[model samples]
Target: MTTNRLWRTLSGFNLSTRKWTQVNPRKARSQVPSNLLSLTSWNIDAFSPRAIARAKLILDHVLHESKPPDIIFLQEVTTAVRASLLQDAGVRGGYLVTDAEDQTAFENVPFATMTLLSRARFAFGSDSTEASEDDEVDGEGDLMIGRVSRMSLPSKYGRDALCVDLIKPAATGTSFRLINVHLDSLGHTLHYRAQQLEILANVLRESGCGGGIIAGDFNAISPEDEGLIDMNQLQDAWTALHGETGVEGATWGVGAKRRDGLGPGRLDKVAILGSKAEAMDVLRPGSIEVPRPGQESIFLPWSDHCGLSCSFTF
Candidate 1:
């Protein structure tokens, strides 16, 4: 698609090209087993050192979950924060990490990037071993680095989607693609988000993968918004497991001292396409508190937006 067409679409203009395009519907390629896979997605709010430090604490805590996530998708991660996460002992042992930033955009816009971390190997038919306490003795595990790619979006802030493919063996012996995205944060209008979603949908369509997981800070208050409707192929994990309701899931602005003139809303999400996503009993929609470094009595949210974790069977 041309840049002008993309801009026009984002501006609420419908393209006749989309109607004429005879794209075949993607079919299910593999049936994933009942093996429960934990996935986590979060917006770290890494605009400052304090926020990055808090994100680190949250990452450390998340790594220690009873059934730790096998894969993680993160957004709003700056270069410094990514470096810190790479060096953190919590992630050093078994995680393979990759990140992508919008190089096409200016450098002063905070340059937030999307990141993916996986414990699975990157080769198909490889032995997939879960990391254990004993595995830490070696300082690293057998997790192979996955293939990573970036798809730039039509945004002034250099927004982009980072995708990683984990090709390790599973009960069903199939590879899985994990996409991490951060849509236009400044654009609240439905048309603006629709344009970004169109770009993302095009990427997914071209990927040709049967099914995979997509998670990020969408910055959309409601999933039913028109912009998000274009992504009908993907199923929202929250709504798939729990039927839609009026009550807001509210992942954003939950535990902040300042609301930033924004009330509680569900912006962060984990959605699945061509796979079944089941919410584990341990999955709870809420905020995690992070205490100040020197002041134990003072506690704040790990991020302006709370971390979201869910378990998927596929």
Candidate 2:
């Protein structure tokens, strides 16, 4: 099926009882500024109940804010969680989600992969003209969606990256590409991660876009690893915003015990290419805490890894 047809079919699947309105250009323009775009990336741990709850909380917090994130890039999303997210009241009302699962789906385990959720109002493409109820199915809007595909990576677990392109104010040819990836897990070595990064970098270079974003659970321990340094065009948002003092920006191992041989580390990252970075930070909800067995309590994050968000004004 075509992308527009697929999007419409997916949107029509009402897993929730609440009725949702179609994208309104006037409301979208009024709610979200054209120049400002906010994005958040998180590895929501296979969509466990606790993880989903926390993810909902984070989304709610942002949606209520004066300026909510325009797009959300999520990794480690499972088929079940994808359905749940779609059925979520807040999510249903605000965003349109698209997902690509790993090629190999284990027998009982939900297929895991990357997912992107774009706010309906702020979605890029189209002019300022509002579509009437009858015109909703015509797919006219402020955001023009284009070229979405799932590229497979060389991995035992059948990992893949979901790549998508968006044009803001459809008339303007200006566009940006967004890539969400979940590389091999701990079972893979640094060299393997490097190989995967190389494939991704090659794809980006070949695309030849003016600017774009690559973000997700890279599983790379250091900046030098994963061939990141080799990509001269892309800048690590964490490093650019925080600098040397921000080395403590750990997003993984938040729920592990010392005996588990896991501790806080920066495995997840957001890399920006050809865009001016405005701000970047880890999103840690106050309620997240790690528990200790009758010892001094430690704060455990909502997931094993914390969420990261970056803002850019082009």
Candidate 3:
């Protein structure tokens, strides 16, 4: 119920917080580049009318998989929905979560971004077991610790970037960071969105991590978005893997129950910020039909937006 590591930046004060939380420190840290690195970015609509069913299916789709992606980014996750995430057994044993323990209110906002790193790929720190919920994972779940940081972005909405840094313990090895972000929404806030990107860029620069990802609901509606992407030194992973196809990459229209007149747009995206991705593809983890006895089966895309999955060389 109480926020573990809440950062509030309402007065332009950067009260960013950084912590190394341990999930599975020793057991999961041995592998290297030979292992495939992958991630999935999604914005599960927290305010959906069918929030409960949607959340259940979303968990089943991502965590129940025999082999889930290495990294996952979820946005617009409300406190109620987050309860489902923290309680899942698979999540407890298989992944390290940002904003899990001691995660204070989302600056009193209803929703915020959360990051999940597979225990198979990343290791965590030794201390902070109290921060973890209930019990720890099997076989020395607290062997190594991983780094997680959050910076309050400049937004009228209580938005912030949840960044998980995969820094190499060794001095010679390379490191990368993954950030889950939801920029300012709507078309009228282009300048505001641009400011958000700038803050993210600075975070990357100051981090000194080699390179990594920035993915989530970018609200990419205006043409200025393209310029903003380049301006922030972020490359469109999908476009690089697959050519730029405007509406083809759209992620948030059909599922939009509200239809805010924004129409169809690729509001959700996976981007590379000073990093390289091997492959990129759209994932419909939320796609499943809800069964009914006599009535026609209802289609649920899980949320208003589709998911983007990618593999990174680093």
Candidate 4:
């Protein structure tokens, strides 16, 4: 894509293109191995009982899919709940991490185990501090504007998001990190989300990996959405690979219901750090509209929110 086109598509370019684009360019060839690594991130809204059952149904669909995600990130879930579910599923998930935000105390719970599950060798990333104040969660009357209203950055509501760095086992090892985030939703504050993104960026910078994938319910709309991330520094895997328009694409819902339709709403995101991975691309909706076998509809109602997954070769 031309520089102008790329800029228009991404819509956010705080830093000059000359300075940022130089960090990394799209690789001539894909870094992905013959065997692709797939991952899924969903906000299960596990706090709700009905949603929990839906999550189970979604998990069942995922496990049945032909090529299940090698790594998965599930949000809004309690650690205890995940433990019991994993036991029931008979699948052992490693590198499990949960959030310790104070809001977790409301139900007498300390933290929600927003889990990062994987079948590969997983390394955990450090957690960001949780938000302590009440106004932080309840955005200061700036919903439509989507910009930060105050000076304080809302700590992740007692539920620190989780990130997992995964490495391929080989004589010449290749590693990448996966950051799963669930930003504040009650308040559509882009500035707050931007701060969270900054934290995640720092995590990737510290990972020492050449590049990594950041995925989650970002809670912000796409660049197309007036109030959203600029995303110029990051490369969107799905949009890059999926060509620009499709329905089964968007990961969010519209109107009264949380997941009301099939329309595309790119609220959920999977962004690849330009400095790290090469030839990043979307894998699940690879080639055709239908999901790869063993992974079909694995995302359905798993959480109130939809799932975001991607694969990048290092």
lDDT of each: 0.54, 0.60, 0.66, 0.44
Error of 1 at 20 (Å): 47
lDDT of 3 by residue, 1-314 (tens): 11233332111011134232333333554344623577788888888566656776776787766668878888888887777777676776677676665557465887888777676665433333212222233333222233566776667887777766554444233446677899988788878789888777666665455676788999887878867777777787878877778767778785454635676677887777666778876666546576788999887678878777788775
TM-score of 4: 0.58
Error of 1 at 258 (Å): 5.9
lDDT of 2 by residue, 96-168 (tens): 6564222233234355554445555434223212212222222444455555666666676667677766555
Query: Which pairs clash in model 1?
Result: none
lDDT-based ranking, best first? Answer: 3, 2, 1, 4
Better of 2 and 3 by TM-score: 3
Best by lDDT: 3
Model 2 C-alpha RMSD vs. true structure (Å) is 6.1
Which is the winner by lDDT between candidate 3 and candidate 4? 3
Best by TM-score: 3
Give the Å shift of residue 308 in candidate 4. Answer: 2.9
Give the Cα error of residue 259 in candidate 4, in Å.
13
RMSD of each: 12.8, 6.1, 7.9, 16.9
lDDT of 4: 0.44
lDDT string for model 4 (1-314, tens) is 10110000001111343211111111122233423556666666665445546556656555556655555666666555554454443233222223212223225433343443332322111211111112121222110101110111245454344444343333123335555666655344556676666666655565345456677777665343322334446666666677565545666552224443334466677777743222322213211122355775333333445666565554
lDDT measured at residue 296 in model 3 versus the true structure, 0 to 100: 96
Runs of candidate 1 with Cα error greater than 4 angstroms are 2-36, 100-109, 120-146, 168-175, 187-189, 222-231, 246-248, 255-261, 280-298
